[model samples]
Target: MLWGKNIYRLSCISSGMSLFSNLMYISFIYSISAKNSDSDAQGLVHPIRDPRLLSGVRPGITSSQGTSLQGSYYLRNSYLRHNLKENQTGVPLFLTISVTDTNSCSPIENALVELWGANNHGLYSGFSKSGSPSSDCSSWLRGAMETDSEGLAKFETLYPGQEENRSLHLYAIIRTDWYEHSKNQTVDSDSSHNAAAIVQIFFPDSLNHQVLNRTDYKITGRQFVKNKQDFIFSSGQGVLKAKAELPKSSICGGVQAHVQISVDAHASQNITVTESPYQCKTNCKAYQNTTEQTTTISATSKHKPHFIPLAVIFFASTYVFYG
Candidate 1:
């Protein structure tokens, strides 16, 4: 979702209050913005409810290289580059991506789901430095996971903070190798239960208000913008919407984001995976076997180190255990 050259501000829409399951309330989500897209709520598994699992996961990415990143590009092998701490800043966010066959609505197991989001202060891990975008790299909030037997992949992360004209959102890309096609390439006869789609999940105004106002998130002294002001939102139609079932007992509270992706069986060419936004190494194979039911992330190379300030580290530890 790049604008012009590098500006990738997606959109900021007031989250709709449409309720999903009884255990969950709508937070932020995509509205399947494609024309003639299916409106049916689709998923291949039961919603998540385990509190321990919900809180134990640590999600967030660090743009620590303190380098300026180009306007927009897809992050590669994101699952391994993040940390696994439970106490991250801002509101704790848990997300689940469900994959299913377009025809039967059956779950697509082992599908790789890659995710990346900016911290509460509007900086992305490994992509932004000292509050500005960078080409240098770091890792924490960026990562990936695979769908389980039930076609579900979940993560522990935080609510997205707004940047520039865009609203709070997370970037997602579902990758599968069954069929290959490009905008200029024709769809191969190859067919499989898998399909790939790029999506941006937005937040609810009610939730955005809560997260943005928190002392931890507000420390940046940033201004808030609405969906109407965001170009992607104002100009686009059929945005996808997501709902969450949050735990009420934790200090900052934990949430289970239940999101469903829709695929068109016949339109293999149209639904084929989009190219990764970031440039890949010559043979940039992912560090982990993306075909597993569940996967944890970590960096492969030990060199090319990045640094996080001690003050920020101290504040993070305090926020997680003492806040």
Candidate 2:
């Protein structure tokens, strides 16, 4: 009975995990890059100082959602608990974005990136503290990638689901200066020149509906282009659009839901060399003194405003019954 109760509580705490978890893990990446002997080959990547400040309107095209529905996991309860290899879905979708110095037009090989989003069913894959049965809560859906001198970084996972109010999104947090040859480096003016973009990628409204059901996803906007859709994904026109639509495949060994879309980043942009090419790590003392420390505010506090008191009541109920 005690063991059963413990398991029940564990399940309750993490009924689902989402892309938001990736946002919190941004501070933990340590700087290290693979070494190469050639001087022409070896390059410097600057640490980003204030990532949020570099933002403008998100371009209509992006590298990354907000989501509603439950998805079908092919694995049964028996398979879910102990053995997890690849997700039963065939190959989870993979997307790569190359970080470049705007001036030098070179790869920002050491840029650190954190990414997260919902699964195809519109649920986030990893959201909380419970141990994942089919996989570790800290598994591969979200991860950190360092760019190569070629200025490229890649991630492999499934496409996200569309949720109400929130549009489809892929949230990413990037740290500059955490690259090869530049470990533990401070952000000098030479390295502090920040030029990075956090843009969203969107599917055509027709395709979005086709993936789920047309009746469910009605087109609300005025114009339709072969490529254009979401305002968040409007920039970097050449690199951001999907090359082709992907057909459905398996999630694991089991059959996966039909896949309606897939994309590859093929656009090339000019990168400029900077006085400094990388941003300093946020945890670094020099960086921290200059940067504002962050604190968590409840999402509802900004929205519903009265959510804190209701949350307290909910917590009290949990303490009385489950505690």
| Number of the top-ranking candidate, with TM-score as the measure | 1
Please list the C-alpha lDDT of all candidates, in the order they appear: 0.48, 0.35
Task: Write the residue-wise lDDT of candidate 1 on 1-323 in tens digits.
Answer: 34542332211111111112211211111122221122111111211222111111111222221122112544443433223223347777877778776877877665556677777777665545332333345545666665678878887778876675677777776544322112112111122222345566666666676677777677455577675665555545324457866566742775667788854322332233323344332322332123321112222222112334445544544454334
Candidate 1 error regions (>4 Å): 1-73, 80-88, 130-135, 178-195, 219-221, 235-238, 249-251, 265-323
Worst 10 residues of 1 by lDDT: 35-44
Find the number of clashing residue pairs for candidate 2. Answer: 57
The global Cα lDDT (0 to 1) of model 2 is 0.35
In the range 1-323, model 2's lDDT, one tens digit per residue, is 99998998766554322222332232122111111112212223322233422222222222222110111221100110112223523224556655555555555555554444554544443332233332223232434555556555665655545543444545443335322223223222222222243234444455544444422323354122333444445443322343324445532222122111111122221122121112223232322212111111111111121212334445544554456
- Model 2 regions more than 4 Å off: 1-91, 125-140, 179-196, 213-323
